[model samples]
Target: MNIAIGCDDAAVEFKNILKDYLVSLGYEYTDYSEAPKHSSNLYADVAERVARAVASNKHERGLIVCGTGIGVSIMANKVPGIRAALCHDVFSAVRARKSNGAQIITMGSRVIGPELAKTVLKSWLDADQIDESSLPKVQRIMELEDAIQLG
Candidate 1:
């Protein structure tokens, strides 16, 4: 699957780990790592870039990371058409997509280790693998993304 990944300085270590994992899995991904590890990095801004790329319909999903994941998720969600969720556990990641149809997942560098982070990714990817066949619930929830109360 084509994935979009982004991270700030605080998430660099974890991001590097995920990068190799993604490579080994032969998953083609686009990364928005600010400053190239030379200068300072801004989590919120990088998250926004990742969200925007996903919103453009180029990639199927996105993964964002930062110190605590909260701030990055907030910033990514602020962008229209991007439903970014901060998932600290497997269940959260599942529900994020199953219930809300979130297209982006966020993780905390301080909260999860590389192994668990991989599990979270795998869980979400598993959800993506599930056939939508007659899943009205998923369709209805996903349709909410198109809803606009233009008063």
Candidate 2:
């Protein structure tokens, strides 16, 4: 699957690592954050770009990274129809896709090591099918987004 990936200055290393991992796994990815390694671009901006790419179906999924992951996750989720999950562990990564049908996964560079991050990313990527029982809940989430947008 094609993946949209981005990161702020704080997570450039993590992004590079993940990009190599994606290649090793035979997945294609587009880098949304092309700024210099230590550029001042805001994490929210990168997150929005990646989130929009996925929301528009330009990419199948998105991966965003920030200092704490929280900032990017919050910003990405602000976009309509986007479910961005901040996942630091394997279980959360899997559930983000299977239970919430999240199209975007955010990682914290400061909180997770490279090996653990790879494991989390792999788990998320492998969780391609959403559980049938969670369909209604996922639908409810989309409905809520619509409700808020129409308000």
Candidate 3:
């Protein structure tokens, strides 16, 4: 899947680390960022852009980061069709994808180290949808399919 990623100053290092992880896993991606960290950085702007990109289907998945992860997650979800989840553990990450079909995974720079972040991303990718009734968040995908006559 093609992923869109973004971060503010607080998570630049973490973003780059995760970007490398995505590359190693052979995922296509694009990034929106605040600064290079050698210079000034901003979180809000990057978050909005990343959210919009995903909302527009520029990428099917997104990863965003901020100091606490909450800021980016909250901002991304403000966009319709963008289910951005702030995940600190592997379970939440996986459940977010399976239940919500979340397009964005937001992480806190200070909350999770690179190794744990990698694990969570893998879990998110590997998880399967539980069942039709268990996936209210992704019910839209089913609704779309149900619209087809298949006749």
Top-lDDT candidate index: 2
Estimate candidate 1's alpha-carbon lDDT, on a 0 to 1 scale.
Answer: 0.82
Model 1 TM-score is: 0.82
| Candidate 2 residue pairs that clash | none
lDDT of 1 by residue, 1-151 (tens): 7899999889889988887787787888898876455545688779888899899998989989888999999999877777788898999888787766789999999999999999897787667633365367656644664575232
lDDT score, candidate 1, position 151: 23
Q: Which 10 successive residues of model 2 have the least lDDT summed?
A: 33-42
The runs of at least 3 residues in candidate 3 whose Cα sits more than 4 Å from the true structure, single-residue gaps closed, are 34-41, 128-130, 140-151
Off by over 4 Å in 1: 35-41, 129-151
Q: Measured by C-alpha RMSD in angstroms, how accurate is candidate 2?
A: 2.4
Q: Rank the candidates by lDDT, best first.
A: 2, 1, 3
Q: List clashing residue pairs in candidate 1.
A: none
- Model 3: lDDT of residue 25: 92
Model 1, residue 102: distance off in Å is 1.2
lDDT of the structure predicted as candidate 3: 0.82
Which tens-of-lDDT digit does each residue in 52-127 have in candidate 2?
8999999989999989999999999998989999999999999999999999999999999999999999999999
lDDT for each candidate structure: 0.82, 0.94, 0.82
Error of 2 at 144 (Å): 1.0
